[model samples]
Target chain A: MSLEASFADEPAFVPYLAAGDPDYESSLAYVEALARGGADAIELGLPFSEPIAEGSTIQEAIVRALEAGMTVDRYFEFVADLDVDVPLVCMTYYNLIYQYGDEQGPRPFVRKAAEVGLSGFVVPDLPAEEAGPLRDACDEFGLDLVFIVAPTTEGERLERMREQVSGYVYVQARLGTTGARDEVSDYTERSLARIEDWDVPKAVGFGIKSGDHAERIVSAGADGIIVGSALVDIVAEGHENDDATEEVAQRLEDKARELKQGALRGAGDRPRVE
Target chain B: MSTSKFGDYGGQYVPEALMPAIEELTDAYERYVLNNEDGFIDEFRQRMRDFGGRPTPLQYAEQLSARYDTDVYLKREDLLHGGAHKLNNALGQVLLAKYMGKERIIAETGAGQHGTATAMAAAHLDMPCVIYMGETDIARQRPNVFRIRINGAEVNPVTTGRGTLKEAISETMRDWATTVENTHYVIGSVVGPAPFPSMVRDFQALISEEAREQIQEQAGTLPDAVLACAGGGSNTMGTFHHFVDDSAVDLYAVEAGGSSLSVDEEAGVAPNSASLSTGEEGVLHGARTKVLQDTDGQIMESHSVSAGLDYAGVGPELAHLVDSGRVDPVNVDDDVALEAFHRLSQDEGVIPALETAHAFGYLEEHHDELGDTVVVNVSGRGDKDLETVIEETMERDLSIAPDMSIFREVGGGAL
Candidate 1:
């Protein structure tokens, strides 16, 4: 399914997983499980040595995946071979995209993504202001270039960003890096209120973990919710076992199911932001 | 959409959260620092004179000139208040932060010279300071760490990504993104996004300004060339700024070559932080500068005996200058820098920082080809590097000749 189609009826439930965590085959299985569990979209994090936007949890996950020999080409190969129905989005830093074609340009990277059937890209470090090349490349390749709007962004800046963004906007729930918090701050509600007039679809992330957090953000007028570190934590827990593929996949599927249910409940209780 | 650029080398490649902060910083810099309409320039100059010991000496290195058969002058930034050229930028940034009404300051340090300088500035300005330093750097540069603490700044040790300057910068950027409301990130070099490279360079241009006047007064003409070591390239930019418009004066930037410029995969030894020498054009640490990265664009870890000269990427301005053929890039290996470090101390009683020694090393090797008059920026003092210099020199002496003569003579029988 396309990302736009997934967000048509209900609030989208997107689960982020670092690609090739533990192993490629196991990560692919987790993607399949997430798709089966009704994840609207899956954000496959391309492992980078330095992920400045990430907190310790995601940072450790990237390091583990990289140590297990995960490369950008390997990630594309995995995506090409995966049998998942949900649209897959590659989330990473800009350097990976810049270096994908051996410094030629972002064209090769976009072409590879298109060939692999990837739906979009979400580069945390590549802000919309500096996203011309990547946006143009994504446009040429028929891919979405998602832009992030932080709680710190306001008024004219939000409107300006809305114009550049193609896919759903990734709304940050808090002011800090990607990590889980016990409760969502009031800033999310305020930020959502500020951008409620925006025409673009919004997916609140960062510090989002539980189903309740998802419900609150969606109730406050978000079109979707993104859960990353929490899902990665489950994978980390499962990897402690001797043989963890099935167990990890099962846990991921269960978590995706719960978050999807929360999203559905929120969508049912409140009118869609659109 | 292009926030800023030094040719095609710099831009705001940061997260959306930092856009407003960067804009605010740019606006404030344009109004107060650049225009100087608010009397900020006069106040800054007075502070530099009273607190930072401005107009650092431009001493003619008589012994070095006699040995090299050329006139060698040293911009003696080591004699500045904080014992380095770092204070020029640090003092100016701290004052700008004060002008912006920021009560707290954040900075990153490699060898801790910048941290010490920042800490001293913060203490003088009566502001709270937090410094992010690599854990490995904290261990090696103990005196500098102590200096930072004694100057009333908190030192947060970063243990990620090889525990060096790059990691420290990343951590500092992250902190600044979160705490940008009331704190100013005093970037230690001519790197980072937009206004930082330009702002830091403008503040540090005092080095070249003073050196230009002093050199002209001492030599009755502009020097043939100006040389300084390039890590993040602040001192190099400062030393080369005034001379940039003067086409006759040659500019040379010496980068650290560590053990060697060639990477030995078999021995697991990576080439040093010679970005302009061996790196390709790429974005790193918020600027599109020459960076040491693998084919996949993963930033390679840089190696150098001097922590200050160990960075995978250079400043965007220096990258532009190198690309434009306005400034020549040179590489100095660790051994030759070590020799220059000792030579400066014993022969001229001027103990140079390891980073500064790289520039001297370049001069030692190519003084004959250079014009009769040359000015090398001695960017920092070697007091913070005593331990590293002693340890490395002892090891090299033992490996070379097993003779204690050189050590005895240099150490003045203290050993």
Candidate 2:
């Protein structure tokens, strides 16, 4: 399915999981589970060694993935083998994208992502100001280039982001890095309001954990909800407990359904806006 | 989008969440640093003198000069407060944070020199400070960790991704992103997104600013060559900034060659911190610079016996300088650096930090090639490196190193 179509009818449920988090086989199964659990789209993390945008939870997940021999080559192989219907976006640092292939630019990575059926990208380190190369490459590949809009982003910077962002704008719900939190940020509603005019689905992420967080974010006028570290927590728990892959996959799938349903319920709660 | 650049090297490559902070920092850097708004530069200089013990000596090394058959001088950054040049930038940043009305300060450190210096600055400035140190570094540099805590700054352990400077930087960036409204991230080196590379260099440029004048007054002319170690290139940039316009003066940035120049691609490890000597153009931390990465474009874990010089990337301005042929990038291996560490202690009656030893090792090899008058930046004192040196020294069979360790492997003998 096209990535844009995922948010066309209703609030989209975008679940993020590091590619090959525990191991290749188990991680692939977990991703397929999320797809089975009604994830409208998925952010497949290409684990960079330095994930500055991540908190401890996702950091540990990336460490585990890197330790499990998850290189870019291996990541592509994992992605190509996965037969999920949802659109997949590669979430990672800009280095992995800029340093890919022989030409020493973003084009090669963008072309490779298109070849691997990646619908878009969410480079945490590549702000809209320096995203020209990747944006042009994504345009050439007919892939979307997503940018995050924080609560602090406003004025000329917001307009620049509005021009470049595509597929979906990942609205950072708080000031901090990506992690799961119990309490919702007071900044999320204001952040959504700041980018309300941008012509794309606004997916609020960072510190989103439960189905309730998902519902509130969607109810706060977000067209989508992105859940990351919470899902990685399950992966970490399963790995730590040495639980069976099927058991972890079952848990991830169930959690995905809960979050997706919560997002749908939030769509019902949103006041009808003209 | 109007961020400063260093010939296409420096730019704001940070996450969008950090753009606002980066913008604010850029504005502050220009207003206070460039324009000297509110006499910020005046106050910063005053504090650097009163608090940081600036104008560290440019001592002429008689023994080294005779041995190398050249006039060798040491720009004694080691004599500075906090035992390193780190205080210059740390105090500058901490003071600037005050001017920006930032209530708190945050920084990252690998070897703990920068952390300790920053902690001291924060204390002197009466600001709450937190330093993110990699768990590995916290264990390796316990003395410095304690030093930071003693200064009343919190030492938060970063436990991810090999637990080193790179991880520490990422952790600190995370903290800054959250608390940017009231907290200022005093980045340890001249790396990261613009105004950091430029601003930190401006703060650190005093090294050259003093050395340049001292050489003229003491030796009657600018030194023919200036040498300094390059890790994240804070010291290197500081040493070379003023000399860039001097066409005749040679600048050499000595990088850690570690165990080998080769990398373990499958394991994603570069057994060296020689990013400027052998690195590809890529973004790391927040700027496009020379970085050590593998075929798949993943940043490889960089290694150096000296924790201070162990980083995957160098500063963007340093990269630009190297690419433009203004600054020469050289390296010395771990054994050579250790030997120099011992030689400087015994020969010159001064023990240099492992990071500083890199420059000495380079000088030992290529002193003849460097012009008659040479000045090396003694980046830091060796007190912090005592444990690391003893451990590394015992493992090597060096001619200069004595039996510093009580417990040594039988075959691995020291002189």
Candidate 3:
């Protein structure tokens, strides 16, 4: 229940796309493309109306995603049918899980997820104190309960999080809602240092646009990088351009590696490991 | 009557996530009615009298009545503790929220009337209260800002959207999504999610409910017409609810026209807040209602001198009532409303808020038509607007921007 395996081998993580902005089949192609583009793992986003912490870009994408008829069961079925080589992570809000679980617990989602070959779950709002029941359920079902940490997180909680947190630590690059940003902030650099101190393989997200941004997060000491809205935006824009799904998927894969390359370059600039 | 139909107009156009909440509210209200007998109504009245300072007297405006040709009866909802008729609905929603296992109360406001009332009710219940207001409104309604804070409620300034009612509603919705586990969003107006539209009407129905019985005792018969200004149409609906079913009663909802209806786009009505008079059918802030929009469905700007009546859409239920001929919406110009405010202050010795002045102005026109009998709901006192009015009058030469046409029917002058 740790990132020990994924961390040992550097692999590309892809973001699952929903078709149309609110369209369905378009998203199916998006997932296929990401898989074809060499995505090591995929994260499927479940859309909700009040995503309080999401930026306008992701918010709109979610709206589009939901409009495309993205549902929890649908995502599971999509993964089950696809010949995806990578592990799958389902990203959703607490309400969806609560509703899916009948407000009882996360056992329902975990059980359904296991049946669908889903490897892990990422719920951004679930604090560690409240993560226990879900974590235990995930453990029972041989699924990982992925926890996310932000730049402004306190040190004690970060350490406690490092000890109890399963799967990989999702280290967000910056603060202020989830979205795409143009430049890396000094705050992100400081946060990377904090994540590095935990000595765990951290996957940095939030505003990871180009390979360069991805490179920066990696150089900042991240082992894996999660690219979401940028990839979703690429797919959305590609759909508008009438570009082939494979091309869009290929572009996303290229961008992920490009970001990784930038991080590698930055890593080379870091003081050498003994 | 408006073109927007409630039967046809008030359909659920919300996201699937909100449907359950709406259903829950509808169910709760239906159950409340089944359990709420005359004894329950009497108990509610007793609580309002003992705690909320109700049985708000009907003040006779003899001087104004003499100045005009007809006798004017003022239903003094402004005398209620919290300075407006908002308390009636606040008590109802807060009590309902308590029953729903909601430990916290959230509200959105433009004029702070509803915010203040909600804060007062929340304080009374010792519940945590959060009010989302536009940053712009927070700057103008300082007295209410201080009042809510003093009463142990947090005022979260919403800087998003147009920074008015629309923005406030958006923020409140966002808060509700996260806090839904322990929170009930007590919308001030008779708008928002379905249950809110229905729930708020039931609570504020006290105004017309008591007025019907009380007016019957005073005048020996029902009045010819019931008048109140429409800003989300809460106060009007509150007083008009009991009368809506009364075939003999005429219900009139006056909208702020900002002095002249012909002066297109000069009035600064916060478009998202104004529902009647100008708003078209559209979904906004999570409710299907009347919104002021352009040909392309883009929301248009709204205007009114009073912040309270500055919304762009009327409540969906009110829209329905207006469309179904259950309620009539009349637009009032700013000049007429201001004149009414001054006349009421000088003659009746009761300074009325600009929003209430809209109803006062409507009454001023209909006194002759209605003969001697009429009841107008004075929604709020005018103290908050004294400085603003005085400043505006003193700086008469200051250039105010052009606003949207206030009246659908143009005239020579409002006075």
Candidate 4:
């Protein structure tokens, strides 16, 4: 199934987690729970050693993932092994994608990802201007290329990104790295308003934590809500506390259901605001 | 307008969040730096003269000249303010930040040389400054950490990814993304995404600008070779910029080879920082450059006796120059660099940083190949490396090393 197809009928709930974080076995169960809990599509973080765009939480998660021996080859194997029905997206630094094949370029990685059932990608460090190589490769492989729109993004660069974005537009609700926050940013509505005209679905990410955060973002006119650190927080707690994998997976399922229901409530109440 | 790519080497590989800031900085770079808008270059030169102590002498090394059988000249960047070439770019960027009305200054440091330089510049400009340093570096480079704090800058230890320059840069980048609206990140090298690599090189190019003029005045010709140690290529580019166009003048970039060029793929560590010597083309620190990485495209942990030259990646422009045959990339191992450190100190009365010592090591090995007049950039002083030197010196029995019987008896650094 296409990644954007999840946003067709209702407000989508997308949760992100680092594959092989703490270890391969536990993380897989956590991700499977998110799918069971109504995740429209899932973003799997292919951990890079230097995650420059990440906040402390996700940075630690990536470090743990790497410590657990997650490599590019292993990440693809993990993807293929997943039994989940929702479309998956690989989010990582541009270097891994650009250096995957022996011939040098993004084609080999794109080809491998397509074979593993990945629907799209979210390379945080690959700006739209330098994305020609990756974009062309994705086009040949029939994979979606998602572009993130920061709150500060606008003008010609914004237009350029919108033109290239395929699966869904990652709408950064604020000017910051990824992490869960106590309060929803005031810029969410403004960021959504600026890109409201784009034909693609907009999935707001960064600083999203709870049901209320998801509800507010979707009500702010987002087609979906992308949460990473919040759900990753549960996984982190599981690893730190050394809780059973099934226990942590159950929490993730409950949290994902809460976020999904919140988005639905927002979608149902959107018309009442007018 | 200066293009971003230098023969398919440099391009902006930063995240979409940082693109606006990068674009804005690019515009500011063009206006103030390139066009000299509002007399930015004039003021920059004046400040460089009065504050930074510009036009550091190009002194002939009498003892070294006799030993090498060639007239060896030293471009004394070590004599500049903060005792390093880093102040040139630090002052330029801090002043530019003021011009852009930025309220805060942020930077990352590996061995604390660039951090101290940036702190001094920010203090002089009366801007708030914060430096991100790896926890490992903070513990090792105490004096420089003290210098940065004394200059009224906060040093936040980044305790991730082996606690080195690489992690510190990632932490600083994360900080810039959130606070880019009001904060200016003063990248310490000519390695990051565009405008940065070009802009930092432009600021540092004054080293060559003066050396080129000084050589013509004193020696009546451009030197046969311009040599400088390559870390992230700030000082190397600065030293080589003017000499690059002079076809007769050879440009050599000396890199840190650590213990050996051989890498441990299982450990994911390159026992060298010679990216230009042995690396693959990949994106690192927001630029497409030659980097020390594994087959999985993971950046490996790079090693060097000199903390400053321990980065896994070289500047894209420097990589391009090496690829196009305009410049040569060579390396010296830790033992050789340590010997060079003592050699220059005893021979020329100059205690060169371990990073700069690599160049002298190369000069010692390849003096016969170089033509008569050679100008070597003394990138920084060695006061900051005293403790590291004492410890490393204890491990190796060097013929050139000074007698440290008392230090050795006390188990290192009691003096």
Candidate 5:
């Protein structure tokens, strides 16, 4: 089933994971745990050398993964072992995709992704203006190319993105890079309101840390709630403690469940404009 | 003209949060800089003359020319107000930012020349400025750092990836993504996403424009070739711009050959910062340029005796120029550059920044191959490099004479 179809009944809870964090086997276990913990979709991070949009948490996670010998092909091998029912999307920088394919361009990457049962892509650095090549490649491979809309986006750009985007639109929770914030900014509310009329499935991300943060975003009319740094922080803590693989997986699954429950509380409470 | 491509080289590859700001900059640049509708062009030229000390001399280097057996003329950018050609773009961008109603300015510098120039311009424009520099660069380029702080701008030290120019650029871009509403990013080179490479080249093009006229008036003919060192390719682009269409004139861009381009069998460290000669096509720091990267496309750390030339990538425009055969790319090792640095100082009484010394080093080696008349862009003064030069000279005196075969191994043979 399409990921968008799964969002129709509830505010979908999507948890993000940096691939090969700690190790390949543990990361795969975390994906399954997220699915079992009520994640409607999974956003798997393909580690790049430089992840400018990410704050220190995700940045460290990427560094750890890269040091562990994570590559595009290895990432696919890990994903092939997943048995989850939730849709899985890869979030990465554009350079990886640009260099992934054979001489035929990004088609090889997209083709491999589709063959591996991957749902779509969320490239933060590939803004709508520079997404033509990737978008075309995704189209050829029957995969979705998701684009993001930030608090600073407006006017023709918003409309243009609304028309071009597929799968779902990523609504950034604030004006900054990804990190857990104590409180969600009012800017996210305004951005959500501004784009609510676009008639697209929107997932609010980039600062949604807790169930309360997820509740606030779903209440503000987000079709889905995306959490990244918060989950990665748990995995990082587990690594620091040198916990057993199952123990870390258990902790991540429990947090995913808690955030999913929070998203459910605001499932039908879409904001009504005056 | 609105497109951000130099023959499939440059583009805005930043996050969505920065797209609006990039678009606004593109719009402002088109309206004010390219169109020059509101007398901004005239004001810019007037400021160049009155503030930046423009119409700098086209000096004929008699002693150096005699030594090299060629008619060598120097476009004396070292004599500019800020001691380097950096002020040309700094002053222009700061003015454009003011015209756009931006109250704060941000910049990234490698060797502190661009930071000092930006700080000076910000002080003149009465805007709060912040300059990001790598910790390694800050330690090496201390004098320029002091000059920046004295100019009333905050210097933010970056300690991330490799702690150098590339990391500083990443930090500045991250800062701009959040503070785009009231800030302008005055990039220090002919690199970055869009509008920037084009915009910076347009501002620095004065070097070529003035040199083209001055060389004709002084030497009675256009030079056979123009040479400038390529760090981010700003100085080279400025020096090569006016003569691009002059089919008879050749353009040479020299990059740093750090320790050596060839790997040391015992140490295993290869030469650094020779992106054009030894790098592959990839995207980095916003533009698709030739970058020194590993097989996995990860950006590798670059090395150079000169902080300004220690970058893993070249400007996308220069990458295109290299691919198109319009510009000949050359590499000069640290020892050769040091030799040229001392020779130019002793012969012409003009000390050049280590970065600029690379161009002179190439000319000194290939003088016989160059035509009768040649012009070299003296991009900066060597004041900031005095400490580094002194330290290197002392070290060389203490150690054995270095092997000179690395020069012939990695010189202009590729060209």
Candidate 6:
């Protein structure tokens, strides 16, 4: 009876990669590798002319993706042909959505996105007020409009956000862009506590570096974790060598397994170093 | 046939997404301009009279002319709505869009003048309008930003590229590509693809159309030379059109050179946007004339404090004229432009846009050359540039006399 329960038991979230930095065959293989891993969900990022929030690592990934001639329609094509076993979320900017969306703007993009077998969408710039049109369209199309709540979000905004959003809440651990960081702020601690009280599933991101960070976030209250810059860095490192596709996939799998193992171990027993 | 073939330089170059719309524009422009239809001209001319507040006056700059020993006639385009000659073309495009049945309008602007004007027109017609401006421009020109928004248009801040005019154009192009089906891309200047360069030139050529008759009645002959600045070459070409075939009237196009000309920065290079000076005859952004590019054939971006002239290329028609020895192009440094800005403000009681100061700079350079007569296009007023002038003057005064002790004691100094 619970359509969402089926996905609840699904494996940990897996982030997909575009192969050859942009090479078609290699990228196709990379998507398959992500599916082969215990990834319950896959996030496929489409290259855009501008990526405002993406850090250097993901920016480079996009450059390679673009160099491989990736486009809005081509991303849809890859999704259609892949036959991968997981819910797919397209992570991208609002510019591409604005360009490709319908007369009302982002809503049109969300509607068409639903038609293309997409399970959800994650847009950085579409704030909650602006997200309404997209949310309404997604509801009509039966697609999830995933929203992001940063550590700095207050009670009023958080309550307002919970009423309209679905799928899951992305809890940003730090104030800046998505990348590895040396320290976590007290604001992040308060936010994690606040997110733990929410009814919906929570996913922590931003400065989430290794398996330990993911494990700590999950044990704190996160149902899952999203890793981008760290995974992108590994992919970039592998790109310097001769067969980067499989190697990068192996590296991602190793990290994913580590996070999964850590999730089971829990962060409660670990001494509070902070 | 004239070497200035509108065909070679006025061809279209647009992304595949907006090809249909551009092609339609080309067809509509040709149909309207070339057709012997009296209805189109009647409507266009009537609008210019009633709505556009034309024919703009041609006042003799008695002080400047006497100062330089030349009979300087000033074409007063700054009085027009939106405060520049830019409205001449904006009115033309808005009417054209109405005829074409397009429901929405999209445009790009720097310094927010053109965007402000376009927003005015769209507001008048009750058409939905979207304006893409560089984030930096939006901040610098915040007053104009609020003006356009109040006029019922949305301003989309473009954060890409160097966050200036060129980036704004790129954003506009991208938006046009997507909304081409229902939107009319109202290019702010005489840049972009074919028909646009020529189209905007033709609309703005009204400056010369009236000036020619006025000059003949007053001076008993055509002026010896006509000078104007060449930012996107709109005003320069608009004034130069009537005299292109006169053979006796010399034409000079001055470009911006900010600060010291010899300063290593790309400030005031004579050929900044002067096609003949910096460009090889190649296609760029649609128009086939001269474009500024590197040795590897990539477009070399241009820089100027004046957003209007900050482009890498000039209109191809202007390029042909400069190349064929018909028009002379010169560079004007920012110091000269600032001086001219002050002179025009103090002496004439009119503030000209920094873009138009390039022409004023040219007049300063050739003060001795003009023995008898000259006419300069006072393209736009400097209301938009008060901040620039004040800031630049303050900087100069500070550098000249930085000692706080001297300034404190200088309360006894003369005003």
Best by TM-score: 4
Per-residue lDDT for B277-370 in model 5, tens only? 8877888888888887665566777889999998888889999999999999899988888888888888898999999999999998999888
List RMSD in Å for every model shown: 2.8, 2.1, 13.5, 1.2, 5.0, 16.3
TM-score of chain B of each: 0.95, 0.97, 0.88, 0.98, 0.94, 0.89
Ranking the candidates on lDDT from highest down gives 4, 2, 5, 1, 3, 6
Clashes of each: 0, 0, 40, 0, 0, 6
Candidate 1 chain A lowest-lDDT run of ten: A265-274
Clashing pairs in 5: none
lDDT of candidate 6 over A48-91, digit per residue (tens): 53443455567678777766666677777777777676787877
Write candidate 2's Cα lDDT for A91-113 as tens digits: 98888888788886899988999
Model 2, B1-415: lDDT tens per residue? 4446888798888877788888898899999999999999999988888888888999999999999999999999999998999999999999999999999999999999999999999999999999999999999999999999999999999877789999999889999888888999999999999989999999999999999999999999989999999999999999998999998999999999999999999888999999999998888889989999987778889999999999999999999999999999999999989989988999888889999999999999999899999999999999999878877776677777786554555434532
**Which regions of candidate 2 are displaced past 4 Å?**
B1-3, B403-415
Q: Mind sharing the TM-score for model 1?
A: 0.95
Q: What interface RMSD does each of the candidate structures achieve? A: 1.2, 0.9, 12.2, 0.7, 1.2, 14.8
How do the residues A35-131 of candidate 5 rate in per-residue lDDT, one tens digit apiece?
9999998999998876878887898898788778888788899888888987889998877777776563467788889999998999888777777
What number of backbone clashes does candidate 3 have, counting pairs of residues 3 or more apart or in separate chains? 40
Model 5 residue runs over 4 Å out of place are: A241-243, A268-274, B262-270, B397-415
Candidate 2, after superposition: displacement of residue A188 in Å? Answer: 1.8
Candidate 1 residue lDDT tens string, A19-97: 9887788888988888888888889999876687787788878877877878878888989888988898999888778
- Candidate 2: which docking quality band? high
Q: lDDT per residue, candidate 6, B1-415, as tens digits? A: 1222464455544432344466678778878754624366567778778877889888888788777878888888888777888888777787788777899998888878888888888887778999989897887777789988999999999766456666677667766654566789888777776668778888889999998888887787898888888877888889999899998888988887644323222221322444445555544554556655432233445666676777766787787788778988787866677778777766677788888888887898886775466778888988887665555655564332224354336533321
lDDT of 1 by residue, B132-227 (tens): 999999999998999999999999999876788988988888888778789899999999889899999999999999999999999999999899
Sort the candidates on TM-score, descending order: 4, 2, 1, 5, 3, 6
TM-score of chain B of 1: 0.95
Candidate number that wins on TM-score, 1 or 6: 1
